[model samples]
Target: MVLDFGFLKTEMMGEIDACCDHGMMIWVDDPWIASFLPFTSREASAEVMQQYRAEVRETGQKLIEGPFGKTLLLSQVPTAENLAKHWFRRLAPRVRLRSGNRADLLSVVVWETPNCMATYHAPDLGRSRPGLSPRHSHSEKFPNEIGGIAGEGGNLGSHERSTFSQRF
Candidate 1:
């Protein structure tokens, strides 16, 4: 998985103490591309692949130069959960469009640390299903800790360390 980390600047440190108290960072993963590497070379065009890579790199650059540098201030809380959802929303449509709806973005997980992370699922894309696999089953084990937000489940377990996940 190609994990992209974005450093965001936020002023709301007093409310919820983020893992990165000094500087907040969000991790985004492209698991679909990693999973289908063999098939991607044959099925996907070189231009499409280059464009995807460029876009991902450009996004990280913008976030670093803009938000991380305090040149562009975000209105949101900039928490792990919120950032995960925000990135998921931003990238999902683009992924669908670029891949011609062939790619399935299961979830976007913003990591505050190796142990703590927040995941956002795409409900409309038919990717957010309950009790689908072992990963989903973990939420059931810690329902009280793993709070449900807008049909997307959150895992607060320390053992369940994952930056992002896909169905495959």
Candidate 2:
């Protein structure tokens, strides 16, 4: 599938108190932005990364100075799922605008860790399910592998296994 990758800086905190306060260096790499423009994937990823870094730096500063302290201020809770949807909403329109409506954004997967992730599929593309396929079956492509490795004999726990199954 057409793919692009980027990063976003965010933080999470309590609704009223600063308990469980922490920052998130979110990574959005799998099934990313696709452009029909002349730029290569490397160039596109670099540009997107640069733009997002600038936004994160500026907005993060504002949020830090605001009443919320260092949290990534949002209307909804800054969970991984919400962050994925947030990035999808922010990027999809730009993709359509830049590609002249030639690109189809299948989904945006936000990785909270190496294994844990949250995916946001394009509803307009008939992606009603969370991790199903509208293009091709991932199982057919990699019949006996998880993350391109033969068998599941790594440090993969149940959560990682489930995530890999849904992703690859």
Candidate 3:
């Protein structure tokens, strides 16, 4: 699983763990972007964060062309000076992919819909939400399940907070 990120907040660790719970392996794309935030102000980070988030997302789609074998996460892409407009439009069609222009921070979770194709494909998947393998049943949990949550979205507590680059 590849988790793309933007100046994501410390609060989102729960979501990540829950997804991992569903038998998914998180890749965590663009971790470097978040790692850079502490040295600068929030305003400065948003521009850099947006551009990187978009770039990472586009990269994720190109690789998901084959059958589903692993849990994937594509974090928020930064759309700075040269945003990947064409690729962005290509991958995300069914979901509303928005970002925080102000850099307040962000998190991920899924809302189930009866006819929602995304859930069928990568139920609870964020970013690409790629189509699922035909052999797998809907009842199967992503390998990274934690209690009831799946696909890296788990019940996060203080121990996890250290992994997050806390923002002021």
Candidate 4:
């Protein structure tokens, strides 16, 4: 099972199969993805915390209606960090399971804030990848990739000067 960084291009069936077959939970910081999940009952919902499924669903739908759905504004920094964290959390537990050491069971706990990005926590892991945002318009491979407008010195452009100021 792969917890990918970018949106998985495949259909929903593949994601469902991953969850059912390998216990792969596809949680995203982006709320637009959440609107599709139905949470009438607790057990089958996508939320890490069962209680918040309905809230998540509503927030996702709102974001979908908002500009984030139409725009390509995705934060590459956050995406990569979350991706690495997901892999680390999943891999460590699988290793522990295979080694017959069940003492250190771990799960990726994601807290999704309504109308905002989600946050996840895992124990004892860190990674650093510099100058790698998809928004770096200078990249020939990722031209015009939107979101996270880092200007001079890798800081965000001045709010007054930035095109995203109004939306942000």
Candidate 1 C-alpha lDDT tens digits along 49-126: 455456545653112222233121123446778766655565555544543433334455555675787777666532
lDDT by residue for model 2 (42-81), tens: 8775795566456655543113322233333343456778
Residues 1-168, model 3: lDDT tens digits: 222333232223433333333433323355543442333666766775566457656664211211233343344342321112222233223112322221111112132233221222223333322322223322233322111111211354322211112211
Evaluate candidate 3 by giving its C-alpha RMSD to the native, one decimal. Answer: 19.2
lDDT: which is higher, 2 or 4? 2
Please provide, for model 4 over 1-168, each residue's C-alpha lDDT reduced to its tens digit, 9 standing for 90 to 100: 111212211211232223233232334345653444444544544553333444434432111122222211122223434533543343434434432431122222222333333223333321212332322212234322212221222244322111110010
Cα-based lDDT at residue 132, candidate 1: 30
Error of 4 at 103 (Å): 14
| Global lDDT of model 3 | 0.30
lDDT of candidate 3 at residue 166, scale 0 to 100: 25
Instruction: Give the clash count for each candidate.
Output: 0, 0, 50, 0
Candidate 2, residue 134: the lDDT equals 35
Q: What residue runs in model 2 are displaced by over 4 Å at the alpha carbon? A: 1-71, 126-168
Q: Is 2 or 3 the stronger prediction by TM-score?
A: 2
Name the 10 consecutive residues with the lowest summed lDDT in model 4.
159-168
Better of 1 and 3 by lDDT: 1
